[model samples]
Target: MTSRLKRTLLALSLAISLPAGAANYSIGTGSQSGTYYPLGGMLAKVWSDNIENFNMRAEVTAASVENIIKVSSGQQLVGIAMGDSVASAIQGQAPFRKPLDVAVLFALYPNVVQFIVPADSSINTIADLKGKKISVGAPGSGTRVGSTAILEALGIHQGDFKAQSLNYTATTNALANGQIDAGVIIGSAGVGAITELALTRDIRILSFSQAELAKVHAALPAYSGMEIPAETYSKVTAFTAPAVWNVLVVKKDLDPALATQMLETAFGNMDKISKVIADAKNATVDNMDKLQGVPLHASSQAFLTKMKGQ
Candidate 1:
């Protein structure tokens, strides 16, 4: 081949072999059986497809607390976390040695605190959980943080109950096998684990009384009253529960332009994301107000403002 022809061939080969300006990132998600994992996967796919040279992956993590620490410490690019945990981290709470610098990308959905028990069990109220074997979710998980806070608000300290930290799948299995009296699952309605558990065995979701809810709200102001609608799970009736919004977060210092691009890619593809996770339909510019405590990432705030004006 002529020298000019050879040079042209080499250029073509380089173009095919190297991805110019490629950017790789991972989204820290929760357990495989939980909502965060699937939702994170969907977001990664959509963002990857829409953003030029952007490759994103979903990583299974210990959920909220771990996600926050990882993202804030620059170990991960982004993560999904509970609003309460984000607030706690900002305030330098336990599990967080000191305040973390993080910013909200957007609100995902409300993670309702589901206190699940066997349908026939007599444990109808939060007060009845005293001294019972309970699964308070996995270590460093949002479920654990919310459960511990709710229980403490009700005057049920650590010693008042037998606490077991287990993942959603293990919690369901243990409950099914009569190993634990109840399990605390904090996720969007129709969480996969709870749905699967309800398929084989009848289960009841205990509700918080008005008085109990007041105490909980007083303690954890980030939480608000929410009702898990009737039949959200098989044979489980609607019940009042405390819920906190789940949010996508990124490091505070992420590039404003890149952050805006990420938000645009995700928001523009909401239809696709909602098809995969029904709760994702709630992730809209209007619902940005649902995010509590943490400030919105500058790019996200600008994006929302732009979306609103349009």
Candidate 2:
């Protein structure tokens, strides 16, 4: 072969052997009906659009608990998990027997606990859920974890009510159809399922008094207080509820540079994200430090340090 031809062939061989770019990644999000699904789609779109050769997508799952398990087990590169679920997984608790090998990216927004009851139901308080049919979110969702904890915090046990394991859409359907007297939902303030139910069925969002809030705090310290605005649902005035932070998380072993890149890309375009999901507006660098229990990923920590110095 001629010297020029030989050199050209060698260059082609090397180029073929090199990777195209970062590996394609999947983010585990909640059911198609939940906020996480849409938000995850926007995040995936942003990353894929801005970064060269970035092949990323969002996979809908059971949310929180399942997302955490998937991310910790390397089944997913990242996911949206409730702060409380992250704490439990790290502490080797019920949902997770061992600590999850995951780290935080940032806090997304508050997962406000909404207890929706039919307008004519006699049930009025958290305690009144006893002996009633209630939907406490799907089994593997973070909503389920929070619902269970909040019930327990109020001294209500699993045996207290006829609990149905249904997703947000199912919960709303059941509530509206009178299949369930009450349904507990932990989601954004304007979750669609609840809103749709309100338009047809007179709905009431149960609230907690100061004393009830104290009891909840004693059991789950990660939760703080939040209120649902008066007009959020039909016939439901503003009321106090338990709130937990929703955080973005990734596998602990993710490449540091890649992890940092992911964080920067997501937060740098927060405005775009918020347009898709209103709750994402709360995702800020300042809120990143507010995450509890779960430690920040090494690269995430480094990125924050660099951000602070600027």
Candidate 3:
């Protein structure tokens, strides 16, 4: 074969082997029992089913902190995290020794700081937590960081409140067994565990009223104010609480086309996701700006902005 013809044929063959320009991606989410896991699975299904060349898959791995490590290592194309946690990852704040390379796609919704006590415990306020055994949050999860910060801000340090780093399920069990004074979980109000616990026992979501939220934001400016809707859980009739945004994060260097395709699919099929997890109904183009933790990915920003304009 002539050299020129051979080169042309090789190029054609390579192009043929490719998926006509589709970029498959994976999203790293949290544990199976947590909200992130199911949400990730739904996104993956919608993306693979609708977006061309986008065969996205979701992995139920460790939450935020570990997600940052996975995405930075190029092992995952996307991740879900609390906005504050994202700030810590990129800025190399506590829990992370060095900065990471990650960017934001969009903000889904608020992940509130929920501390469920036994409903009969003596602890009634943040101050009441003093010298009491509290499950701050799961290790490496964003809740842990917020729990620590809130406690410290209230003048309750590690010594002030006994810290037990436990996941939502474990902490739930502990709270019911009277083994722990309080359990901390950072997620949307009516989150699986928190909602169920509320149904079984009267649980109250600790409020960091205007004064308390102000104190917290002063230290970690990344938190954007959030309001927990009325009657989010079964037992509780109404409670509006302050919270931070939970964001969809991705590797900074991801292919632009893939990012665009993924966002297109996600916003396109949000209704389907809403069926499984009703809270996801809030995931829309308008709310995406809530993710200021990292700069918006160009492709996602463009798609979402254009959708907003329409």
lDDT of each: 0.92, 0.87, 0.79
Worst 10 residues of 3 by lDDT: 234-243
How many clashes does the backbone of model 2 have? 0
Question: What tens-digit string does per-residue lDDT give for candidate 1 at 1-310?
Answer: 8999999999999777646888788999999999999999999999888888888899999899999999998888999999999988888888789988898999999999999999999899999999899999999999999999999999999899999999999999999999999999999899999999999999999999889888989999988889778998888899999999999988888999889888888888999899989989999989985876689988888888988999
Encode model 2's per-residue lDDT on 1-310: one tens digit a residue.
8999999999999778645865688888998877899999999999888877677799989999999998988888889989899988888798898987788977888889999898788999888999999999998999999999889988899998999999999999888888998998898898877877888878889999889898888899988888778987766789899898998888778888888788889889999888878989898887886766679889878878888899
**Top lDDT hit:** 1
* TM-score to true structure, per model: 0.93, 0.91, 0.87
lDDT of 3 by residue, 258-304 (tens): 77877877887898899997778878888887666478878877887
Clash statistics: count for each candidate: 0, 0, 0
A best-first ranking of the candidates according to their TM-score comes to 1, 2, 3
TM value for model 1: 0.93
The positional error of residue 195 in candidate 1, measured at the CA in angstroms, is 0.4
Q: What global local distance difference test value does model 3 have?
A: 0.79
> Local error of candidate 1 at 18, Å?
6.8
